[model samples]
Target: MDTPTQHSERDRSSEPDTGPGERSRSSRTRARIASALSWRRVLGGAVAATVALLLFSSYVVQPFLIPSRSMEPTLRVGDRVLVNKLAYRFGAEPKRGDVVVFDGTGSFVREDLDANPLTGLVHGAAASLGLAEPADTDFVKRVVGVGGDRVVCCDARGRLSVNDVTVDEPYLYPGDTASRAPFDIVVPAGALWMMGDHRSRSRDSRDHLGSPGGGMVPVERVTGRVDWLGWPPARAGSLEGTGAFGGVRTPGGAHG
Candidate 1:
């Protein structure tokens, strides 16, 4: 009887030992899982913050690069400017003298008429080649006429005129003609007449006369008003409209 009772006691001790070993291994696995989850949460948070910042910058104040000499003497090639997206948001339309970035996709570039798979591929590859777009492509220019201003080029003394006032464009490039082409048009309401400072080198509203919109940019197509030049420390400055435009008044009963 003593021998059988002793055997039973030994069996019970062995069973308890197995239970502790199994529990120890399970505890280690749970700790590892918790550690992995913590790392996952940390990575997700960082990614979310980065995306939010990009969204804010893109929609509120985007940074744009001057990729061509079309705006030379004002915005040089390779200079980066900051566009204020809110400039026209709060019941304000684009004002004369404000440098702006607009969608020239359909207005100037006919390729925009049809979505080309090739163009998309080329645009994607442009950065790799370090090349600018061909002429009459998307453009960044200054606003000369807004809403109802009558804009004509080459007044009697070779000066651009807005609403019968001769505009002395000091912003015009040194030795650059005010306008090589003669144009006379009453800017349609709800549209803007835009031109580049380097008139000879730029193809702005002057070049798109026969196109669908007749060179007049729709108010809704404007992306934002450019307020500052932020790059090339030497060329950094605010882009103020020439005083010439100040004297010209908006046509009668113009809406703000």
Candidate 2:
């Protein structure tokens, strides 16, 4: 025979002693762990995506914004152009009449100066996405002559001539002349003569003829060719190479 207090004690001990507070605390701890893991996964994915984008833009292709109207009518201000970084890679060279982007340091500009690393990184990333203006040393232009070709402006027909072959530029801005300034120079080996489609508004090779490198952009400095216009839903199309320079001969007399 057990006493009443002993019976009560035995009953209490037989039942589970877990309290609501303890279960609530344990649930909260598990929730925190799950949340932490989720955040880590999200952060890791973001980092990987950024790295992939940067690498693709640096090596394969990049987007460039048209900062000015120098290439207007063909490339308008605010227009975004996709540049093919590998266009001239693997022993290929930039052809005449191709719209190219290059670092104009030591040619267009007196010197090549880099921006602060942090600022440069930010701006470069933005510019690569066509969301910001390119560096001052970067320029976009058409290749009029390349490597040992004789380039003369304003022939008898008021046209630009390359290697004695007159070029009929259909892409020039409406009512704009081939060149208002007179110039005659033979493009040096491994150099290029660049010109703008909007002759009146652009300062191209002719503007720097007296400067160092004779205003000729080195072939090595060429970044890429403009292959597509990718902005403004109303005006998006491929920038195909034209036959304007088809009749011009290569430096070594090879058919162009």
Candidate 3:
């Protein structure tokens, strides 16, 4: 019972057998680490993508939804337009006949008493993605006069005149007059006179003549130019600025 080979085999069997248990614990640890890393990568990627999109929308370009029929025949309700934020970022300025979007707080609206900061932020984000209505003070219209230009409605031929030059607005809505309200105002320096194509239904510069800023929108208030209509698939196209104001003369005797 005490033979040398028998004693060696008994000692080998007495030692703890831990190979399988150790291996199982090591495998589980590795799997948990891998799963954690994968989730972190996915979350980081999503956050980065969201930041990039917001930056692009704020600086390079922005999406705007048509809120009303003010610019009908040119833009329709529910249509989405891409505004070029950099259009006026350089030394260039907004010109006549250019369709522009601007903040009309001091010019078009006396005050926005219903604005809520939290709600505005949420609505603004949704609007930037073309999923909701734009801000209450945001407006889109066509430029009729810019900087020291005299704009008059219903000239001898019942057509709007800029700097005494009659403008042939072929973009006006069907059956809409040039302007039912008579107005004669000289645009101040660094200001713009905007109007909607549907003159009858639009309450534009002509409607706010007695309000503050004389219904003239400051150039600094302009957000961007509506460069393209991006929604409704069938109505998508570039919004080309017309040469209708080409013949109009500025105060300095140069063409506007």
On TM-score, the candidate that comes out on top is: 2
TM-score of candidate 3 versus the correct structure, residues matched by position: 0.86
Instruction: Please give the lDDT score at residue 160 for candidate 3.
Output: 87
Worst 10 residues of 3 by lDDT: 109-118
Tens digit of lDDT per residue, candidate 1, span 61-80?
76677878888788888877
For residue 207, model 3's alpha carbon misses the true position, in angstroms, by 1.2
C-alpha RMSD between model 1 and the true structure: 5.5
Top-down TM-score ranking:
2, 3, 1
Show where candidate 1 strays beyond 4 Å: 1-43, 111-138, 234-237, 253-256
- Number of clashing residue pairs in every model? 0, 0, 0
Candidate 3 residue pairs in clash (backbone atoms < 3 Å): none
Stretches of model 3 off by over 4 angstroms after superposition: 1-36
Q: What value of lDDT does candidate 1 attain over all alpha carbons?
A: 0.77
lDDT of 3 by residue, 113-146 (tens): 7778899888888887777889888999999989
**RMSD per prediction, one decimal?**
5.5, 2.8, 3.2
